[model samples]
Target: MTISAELLPQHVAIIMDGNNRFAKKKHLQKGDGHREGKNVLDPIVEHCRKVGVKALTVYAFSSENWNRPQYEVDLLMKLLEETINEQIPRMIKFQIGLRFIGDRSRLTPELQQLMLQAEQRTATFTEMTLTIAVSYGGMWDIAQTAKTIAQLVKEQKIDVDQVDVDLFAQHVSLGDLPPVDLLIRTGGDYRLSNFLLWQSAYAELYFTETLWPEFTTEELDHAFGVFLGRERRFGKTSEQVQQEKIEN
Candidate 1:
């Protein structure tokens, strides 16, 4: 049966965590887990497309990840380059707009060029959007937004008194898309881990014990089911919301 798009989240952001733990459990190297997790990404993306999800954001790497072993970091960079190069054609073919949110200044110039190429190639796409959060931290995004707003203030583009939530949101990286409706964290983690701190302010949080490498479409559905069972009051009483709808 085709799941109703309304039942599926319009925008879902996932923190792809627990790769190292998954690897350790399987008696494999840490990078091996990440490699295996990479294999699952395409399938998850396809599942989101199938479910009519408008936008999907994945926490691929964090700004703090730079503290990891240099060798692992180097391997991850190579993997990121290879993955983007391999996936661009597929993304374009599938009409999935590709977006990257993070500090690209930390990436190698070659890799940064590849990222730009991917974004440009898929810019015309209007289907689903797949955003990878690489070298990203929610605090960094917020700080960057503040810095931009400060610059705008200096330029006299807007009065400092006019700064508000909506204006700040406009400067966020994923602001063009719908606010995050669901946020998923896998591998037993129960925290946001600095992914989309602003966007997920009212998002439904779903945590699964399944590792990223083992997470499947069925698991995705389970998360959706969980979300569907919730009541989104959005700061209003249920009775108040119902009454407002009735009045409308």
Candidate 2:
């Protein structure tokens, strides 16, 4: 399935899930699913770029992921390091800028170094942006942004009354990217799972039973179709929304 030109989202975010469960179902080791999922990331990201998406944000790892077994976490970090090392050239070839969002403190020095290298290598690309959220949480993002805003106010950089939505957003991760127009979750999930709370306030959401390792371009096209059918009011009445112009 191909996304219709009229229905594609400029900015799409995804919560990639069910790797461990999928591996268990297949009688594979816990980390095997993650490896398979990682293999799929490059293809899906390229698909998004080809389909005219301006930005893509993927929830690779959450802050709560640290609660998992130490072995799993270690394996995941290693997988992350390898993914970055292998994918940087691909990102550059696709003209896709890379950005990392989330707490980097938990990552090992080597992994952190790889992340920086990936971002720097792809910084000049402008066709699209791919953000990998590692050790991320929606509430955590908001709390951190709030703390930054408070500190700014204390320094008299801005007044307390000046802290509005736009100002708050400036401090959040990937604030330079446009608002997320669509949010999808794979693995039969139906929740946000602490991914992008403030950014996805009005994003159209799509849930599918396909696991992260199995999500394909066709699945993404179907999700776009579903997104097209909805009326995005953005807190306005239907009558008010229809009167406005939305670019395809």
TM-score of 2: 0.95
Candidate 2 residue lDDT tens string, 16-92: 99899889989997789999999888888888888889999999889999999999998988888888888888887
| Worst ten in a row by lDDT for model 1 | 1-10
lDDT of each: 0.91, 0.89
- Scored against the true structure, residue 228 in model 2 reaches a CA lDDT of 85
Per-residue lDDT for 126-174 in model 1, tens only? Answer: 7899999999999999999999999999999999998999999999889
Looking at model 2, residue 188 earns an lDDT score of 95
How far out, in Å, is residue 99 in model 1? 0.9
**Residue 77 Cα positional deviation in candidate 1, in Å, after optimal superposition:** 0.9
Per-model TM-score, in order, reads 0.96, 0.95
* Inter-residue clash pairs, candidate 1: none
